[model samples]
Target chain A: MATVAVENYLKHVLLLSEGGEELVSMGDLAGALAVVPGTATAMVKALADEGLLEHQPRLGVRLTTRGRRIALNVLRKHRLVETFLVETLKMDWSKVHAEAEQLEHAVSDEVLDRLDALLGHPRQDPHGDPIPNRAGKIDSQVYATLATCATGRRLRIVRVTEQSEEFLRFAEDSGLRPGAELSVGERNLVSGLVTLTRTDGGKIALGVAAAGKILVEPRG
Target chain B: MATVAVENYLKHVLLLSEGGEELVSMGDLAGALAVVPGTATAMVKALADEGLLEHQPRLGVRLTTRGRRIALNVLRKHRLVETFLVETLKMDWSKVHAEAEQLEHAVSDEVLDRLDALLGHPRQDPHGDPIPNRAGKIDSQVYATLATCATGRRLRIVRVTEQSEEFLRFAEDSGLRPGAELSVGERNLVSGLVTLTRTDGGKIALGVAAAGKILVEPRG
Candidate 1:
């Protein structure tokens, strides 16, 4: 069994690569895990020795089939647990991410399946993140972010890519949660700010960097 | 924040001492934790240094007030998580103990409080084990085990103290779960065996040691 640290490393790698084929940079991996680069290198080498991932000295690491399977399983546990916390326990959605960080490592696959069933097999968590299925398959659909979507066209929020408490609270306060319909009111490329108008006539301004974390799709 | 190993050591010390004022012998602690005596001694010394427990030379160790408080909180998490699993998730009572073992160290106090409220402030878990409160007050009432309860007297199973999977499966299979009302039929001191009769006309026989693990009280 992998230690909790190893699981975190693999899970972060999966997230940082956006579950894509691109090679992750060592700096990005270290930053994502909030560890010094040297520590991250040491662990990456150990994981390589275990055949869970391949470590490219300069480019960084990528999960092998086995590693990706494990990472996906961990991700599945995480999202399902978050869903249970919010939907079943009636916990605050903004707080469930931090709670799920600790719980994902503890829940067994059996318990995860039961929770998934209890939640009626939810496809998305409280944060609108896709939950990997029992077989490790996840919805890989790409969507436009609020920062990049065209101005004046109605879009519904699809997901919030950021997990920070402050960001989530801001998004909630701005009525920018998943399924909320809104249109880009204005964009200032020089100033790197975007203005949004909600269907209810509420307006909110966001920096391009923060706006990029909110994924959206054209309203149907 | 105590590491998982440190938490386990402190929890085991409290359990071995039966939540009493007696010092827990190093041998029993080592055996219970499945570690060598030397490792137990080294850990006890470290924990004593940390002011979590007091260790006496060649005698044993006892939890300091702080250590006892932490242990009780961990126990509370364990029992409440077990209750949530069995009552809310509808998991099998026999399987929840192992699941709760992993979850106890992960759940936050905030989440625990919400779970406690969601379960309607359950006093006893599915196994009939008392759950410590938020303030660390546990129901410490002592009761006679099936091995010691008088023959021909009606008794209700109060708690199944053993958490081993095999023991729990056997208990469940034999209709000896918590709250089951029955009477002791016979006891053989020399043979180390006990016979019991359920109110529903079912008969079961258990070894004296196993019988002692099933606590009971006079039936109302």
Candidate 2:
């Protein structure tokens, strides 16, 4: 069984890979995990020896099939726990992520299954991140972001990929959340800003970087 | 911020002390924690230096006020998580203890408070173990066990202090759980056996050691 540190490392690798074959750089992995580069390198070598991942000298690391399975399971526990905290416990959505970080390592598969059933098997958590299924399968559908989607087209928020509490609070204050209906009124690439108009006739301006974190799909 | 090992050591010390001022023996602590006496001694010294506990050389270790507070909080987390597992998740009572053992170390106070409210501020967990309050207050009432209680007097099982899965399963099979009403029909100290009769007319026999684990109070 993986230790909490091992689980965190594997989960971050999967998140940084973004459902692609791209190798996660050591610096990026260290940064995501809040560890020094040397520590990440040593741990990556150990994981490679354990056959959880493949490490290329001077390049980066990528998850093996086994590694991805463990990572997905951890991610599933995290997102489902976050959902339970928000929906069942009525905890603040912005705070659930931090709570879930600790719980994800401790929850057993049996408890996860029960939590899944109690939450009616939600597909997405409060942060709009996908919850992996019992078999560790995650939804990999692509959606355009507010920064890139066509202006004047009605869109529904599908995900808010950022998890920082401050960012989530700001987004919540602006009524930017999954299933909210809106359209991009204008995109000013020169000024790196995006203007959005909610269906309720409210306007909000976001920097292009922040806008890119909010995924959307055309309203069906 | 105790690590998992530190938390376990302190929690076990508290349990072995049995809500008394008596010092917990190093041998007993070692046995409970599954570590060698030397290891227990070394760790106890470290904890003492940290002001979590006091170790009397060659005698025993005792929790300081700070140590007791931490231990009680961990116990509260454990029992409350167990309650949530059984009540909300509908998990098998026989299995929740082991699950809660892992979760107790990970759940934050905020999450625990929410769970306490969700479970309607339960005072006792599924096994009739008293949960400590947020302020570390615990009910430490004393009760007699079937091995020592007056024979032929109606008694209700108040707690089953044993946590082994096999014992719990056997107790469940025999309906010897907390809140079960029964009377000791006979006790043969010479043979180290106790025979019990349930209020519903079922009979079961247990060895004195096993009987001692099931605490009972006067039936209402």
lDDT score, candidate 1, position B119? 97
* Candidate 2 error regions (>4 Å): none
Q: lDDT score, residue A125, model 2?
A: 95
Model 1 Cα lDDT, one tens digit per residue, B93-133:
99999999999999999999999999999999989999999
Give the Cα error of residue B74 in candidate 2, in Å: 0.3
Q: Write one digit per residue (lDDT tens) for candidate 2, span B134-157.
A: 988999898899988999999999
lDDT of each: 0.93, 0.94
Give a tens-digit lDDT track for model 2, residues A57-166: 79999999999999999999999999999999999888889999999999999999989999999999997898999998889999999988999999999999999999
Candidate 2 pairs with clashing backbones: none
Q: Specify the highest-DockQ model's number.
A: 2
TM-score of 1: 0.98
Docking quality class, candidate 1: high
